[model samples]
Target: MDEVLNFIIAAYPDDTLKELIQIKLSLDKTGTVQVSVSNAGPPVHLDRIPRFEPSAPTESNLDGLWYFLAKNFVDHLEFRNLGMDGWQAVLERRLSAASFEPRKADSEGSIDEEIAQFEVRPGRHDDAAELVDLTYDTYGYSYTGPDFYHPSNLSHHLASGEIVSIVATADGVIVGNTSISYPPETPCCAYLGALMVKRSYRRSKAIELMISETVAPAIGNRP
Candidate 1:
């Protein structure tokens, strides 16, 4: 993820003062993994999404050499223009052989009812404990990110301007969280960080709102 993001940042023009970037990782029951990167700079037309035949892996000087090497391994790669929304590149790969049952359709509308009450806001110092607990509950120590395992570390990072966290709460309890980080070398770019929602709140808009309504808008307002 870091390698791909850095390459994307390098492609941006040097004069831009601000940028909005989003990365989404999705996994389906059939075990296909998709990584999407979107930027709020320009809309790339659908016709511009690469459609060239695969070439043998070889040395090249193209700016998109990383894309070439990656496209060779991933099952699918495509780009899309989102009009007013921005541009996106999606890469997909199948990783699992076993399939699981799909989620049940929302017939009773309970999922909507539950998410309607979520409150999104920037995270605070006091939110550290709950954030760490939530991470543990979700990943059971298997999560590779070490900072999330320590509340003090999270608080420190939040204080040092290393990250900005947007959290979704229900009745004042954090139910979902996401973050944004600006790479020092890329002043015009910001990277989307990890997003996690409580098991019970996974079906809600808590994740979406944290990114779209809170985090992105907050970064846009930065000086």
Candidate 2:
């Protein structure tokens, strides 16, 4: 029971546990366990809720218990700044195995001239709000993931140098953005995330331009 509570706290760090109206846990003699939680808040919209399908636990399931819990019960789950060493190692190993190899860049002189119409550069602290607005424009409010969608969170990441962002602006309006974040403990690796482009410009080769002009240069500068 304590383990389950700890797992909940770890998975939903942003939620207030005190607001939960009820929590029920049941474990049978066969080792099958069930948990139900009710929180005092606005009723959850059905479309927003994640459906859970029961699966018998097996030894071959490499993802820890938290994975199942999050997939079954939560809208989203993120494991950041949680001091669970073992879980972090498992997550890192899984991510590293699936990581893409950084691509090489072409010489500037050989690149497409059309890319010059859009400015591609490293993002600044002041760009956080614009970045969030770009995200909303791209994915809408229902988008839930690890990307920092708020200016304050983005600012914290930028200040810490944990993330390096690249933005593409056309005539002073941001139309595209992407970021690569370094895991503090992983010196040789970085995770690329939050790649987005306004719908009208999706076919403009903006992503390729950002990768060539921004991502490649930034990654090369890393020690």
Candidate 3:
């Protein structure tokens, strides 16, 4: 029976496509075996590796570096790649849930002609896709379309809970939109976002109606 041993073999980082070899042993007159030359290997300086350094990340050098010294091998590695697609997906989905954009047809130069109707209620989550398009179309925003809400990352808040929404229909079409984040934390904390109306919806009083209708009800829920 022979002894099984494991050892690390270090090669110059510049070259890789080589095989690792093991050295043999020799015997002396006293029957003692020696393997000094075979045991000697290269010295490792672990501190030189970039990963273990004391440097803060910058916009340029955000990628941290690292090096290692194994039994007989040295390794250099770098880690600095993150994906933005996932983040954009999240942002778009959130925008879909919160953003509201309504368009108006005729600019009557006053609030009376613009506002077709006003409603104080939650934004319709079931029709988010349609609302997203309506909002985008009203604003004249040239996007590929709304951030697609695929089922893979569907959010519950936008689905289960309701958000305060104000809708103004102009000439039988929803022309203005507003929304407020609900389920207030800290008894009075509310978030407002994604408030938009089309250029054609330029009426001073309509803005007041949207602001009042969307915000007033939720705060009333507090006390």
Candidate 4:
């Protein structure tokens, strides 16, 4: 059951609702396994319904696994467990089936070549439409969050200075994005979230660039 436990841990890295979620796994004398997930948190909002449906044990249903954890849990998700071949196979199959077009590494030569064509800078209100499209392309309808996925909502957040968004543009097209959310009560601390890069650019140092160039500057500028 270590694999199952690892899956859960990898699925829900953020403890945002950790204390509110409980997981139970049981195996009877007959060897039948049962898994249960319960939410003890406050009532879920109408627009933010959970999207996870448990998959049958016999099949390695990667799409079901990702839908449950990524779409149902939160808008932004990342996984670093590179050694899990099973999970990786699932991702490859799913992305191919969905016709997800990520940047082609073979055509781009080296990582440096790819990074050279991309530019990262503070996001503008005009970027709201492209950013919304990027989120929709990445997460689809599963991400119902109004903050970043909606153009008007993103513009409001940007205008109010509640969120500092950094956008990556390749050939004048928005391809990668990340943001830092500042809590009004905690002046010194900022929550870095909404990090996403187009599948094609993921092989490059885009994330590192966002952290070092955009996120760091925003946090340092906070008073």
Evaluate residue 209 in candidate 1 and report its C-alpha lDDT on the 0 to 100 scale.
89
By lDDT, the better pick of 2 and 3 is 2
Q: What is the TM-score of candidate 3?
A: 0.35
* Candidate 3 displacement at residue 113 in angstroms: 2.1
Candidate 3 lDDT over 1-223, as tens digits, reads 0111122233233344432224445443444433321212233333443342334544433222212222112121222112331110000001213333444446544455434455434444554554565556555554332331322111234464434445665554555666555553543655565656655556545566777776564442432
Local accuracy of candidate 1 as per-residue lDDT tens digits, 1-223 = 5545665676677646446788899887778989999976654443443443345433333444556566677899777778777777888899857567766543433456453698888877678889898887667888666777888988876766666778889888998888666545776877676678777677777877887765354453453
Output the number of the lDDT-best candidate: 1
Q: Which ten residues in a row have the lowest lDDT in candidate 2?
A: 85-94
TM-score winner between candidates 1 and 4: 4
Model 3 residue runs over 4 Å out of place are 1-120, 138-158, 182-188, 217-223
Off by over 4 Å in 1: 1-116, 183-189, 214-217, 220-223
CA lDDT scores, all candidates in order? 0.71, 0.59, 0.40, 0.58
lDDT of 4: 0.58
Clashes of 4: 1
User: Whole-model lDDT for model 3 versus the true structure?
Assistant: 0.40
TM-score of each: 0.44, 0.45, 0.35, 0.45
Give a tens-digit lDDT track for model 2, residues 62-135: 33554456544533333222222112211111121333344443232232446547888788777888888888
